[model samples]
Target chain A: MNLSELLDNRDGQVYRLLFYDCRPLLQHILANYNINDSQREYDCIMDFYLYLRGDEEPFAMLTAIKSEKALPSWLKTVFSRFMARRANHDGQTDYSDSAFDKIPDDEEDSRIFTISDLNTAITLIEQINTSYSAPERVIFFADIDALASNRHSTDEIISVLHCTEGNLRVMRHRLKKRVQQTLAKLTTND
Target chain B: MTDTLIYKYAYNQCTPDERRAVRDMLVSDFSECFAVVGLMKTRAVNDIESSMLKAPALALAVSPKERRKTLEKGRRGLPDVDACKNAPAPKALPDIAYDEEMAEMSEPIMIKEQAFGMSMYFDEMPLQPAPDFLGILNRYLQSE
Candidate 1:
């Protein structure tokens, strides 16, 4: 069941093409996050693979947002998106509700820090981002991923994004607020 | 992990931060490190299996009933728990305010809008990206 062999299967074919086409995107994203944890990166890539298999939303955005001038850069835009999502942590924290009693500062809850937890965190972030405008969400997540990957300051992000510091602050504020709300929901569900 | 460390360490090309990181990884992951000599001795650049080892090599789509058969043939890869025919149903996600919408969204999804007396496909992108779209998948995957 090696890659060379799996290339014969439909899923394998899709993965092979993906591996070829998105190598740079994944490499850049990999350099930023999950470099120390290759397995987690693998799982994240596999998740994308399944979606490619499914022909599923954001995936089709590549074609949906097609315009002659924008077509070529669309792939880069999409890569920026997921790379942002994967790095959504951005050193953010939410207040734990009393309903979810305060966890002791005990040993690590590896389960809570596992790859699945990160997946759930990503899901919650996406759910919260649903109401935001497309451009806003893209900038927000990409900025967040930038923070995680580059450990950049607000000043740096503002400069890199060619946006004002006020705009960056507002984006960070909105992101943190959404993260808190999502954490509340996850807390109740957990 | 071992291969990564060995390559970085022996080359002496690591940045100060990377050197610290490698030290930390070594302290934290002693057991997972490969034997430096043995790994080098056995590894050949021409080995396709070695190069593709980290790639999603196993391509499988099987009902639980057939999973056992597959396992009988080879149990070397990551075990797919859902492949077991008799495995218990996945626990339902606890009902939250948006539970129904979330559950419905677990399926293939689309966002449709009617505007200006017409059905406008605003952000009507599907997750089925051609040539493997990553960001879109993460967007939809996180939502699911």
Candidate 2:
């Protein structure tokens, strides 16, 4: 139905289309997960529509999936997360290991490590890691950003960083610990 | 998956067997991942919407006079439509005439015309005698 033409709008029609189109998908997903709340489903749909109103690329992307006629993969996660936040309305997210086990596959979570957050984390590392050498910091951030793109293989990373398996493992260990601390601070402060 | 394990998974650090197991678990338990998505959308709202909304108010606040001045300035540079549509026609050309003396020399003639300038130049250059032509012509008559 020429979704781009419809969605590349700062108009009422775009909102109407998104409401009619995404409502059922949001309902189906929530229903599948047994949340069963029409209000929450409507809330998710409204959130998506409002989100779409402010930007074009996301709408362009969502529209491009017209043939699929399903909730775009990312939005499914987004809607689910919306419900989860409603569930966690009290305060700070629980930071226990149980929390990790609870939501492992959510690539776009509260601690999802955004680019700005990553930049802040990098700056924090620079300020904090007085002992880490210049080359080490360079390799560490470079490797982390590449990993974040989620496109590289382990062998590719090892070769690019010019490190052996044992050395790379140690580097990853150090990076994981540092990133966890930095992102924790960044998320809580936000 | 442990938080460390999830971090490793995000970075492609987990081995294949570990990766498979973790993915299976996450898929089997998909609903909890919603909170993470919720946080992401919250961060994105801050990331984009605020900046986008700021630009429009600044755009609209430009004084009407300033906008009019800019519009007039842009119009000033455009070519005049009347001037383009009524471009004058080319001036008429003088007629061609054969020169009797030049024709007597039996030389090759040259003609040049400049259309817009409405000018033409004519001259005749000496044509070199060629053995082949003379031989062909010889059969029709006596050689000079």
The candidate that achieves the highest TM-score relative to the unseen native structure: 1
Candidate 2 vs. true structure, TM-score: 0.21
Those runs of model 2 whose alpha carbons end farther than 4 Å from true positions after fitting are A1-5, A8-11, A32-34, A63-190, B1-144
**Residues A41-84 of candidate 1: C-alpha lDDT, one tens digit per residue:** 44455445544444545444543543423422454455556557
- With a 3 Å backbone cut-off (N, CA, C), the pairs that clash in candidate 1 are A55-B128, A56-B126, A56-B127, A56-B128, A57-B126, A57-B127, A60-B126, A123-B142
Where does candidate 2 chain A have its weakest 10-residue lDDT segment? A126-135
Candidate 2 docks with a DockQ of 0.01
Interface RMSD of 2: 35.9
Q: What does candidate 2's lDDT look like per residue over B1-144, in tens digits?
A: 243333333322445565555455444443212222222222222222121111122212223454354445442232232343344422322211111112233233232223312121111211222232223212211210
CAPRI quality level assigned to candidate 2 from its DockQ score = incorrect
| Residue A122 miss distance in model 2 (angstroms) | 52
Q: What is the overall TM-score of model 1 with all chains considered together?
A: 0.22
lDDT of 1 by residue, B108-131 (tens): 222222321112211221222211
How much is the lDDT of residue B130 in candidate 1? Answer: 18
Worst 10 residues of 2 chain B by lDDT: B116-125
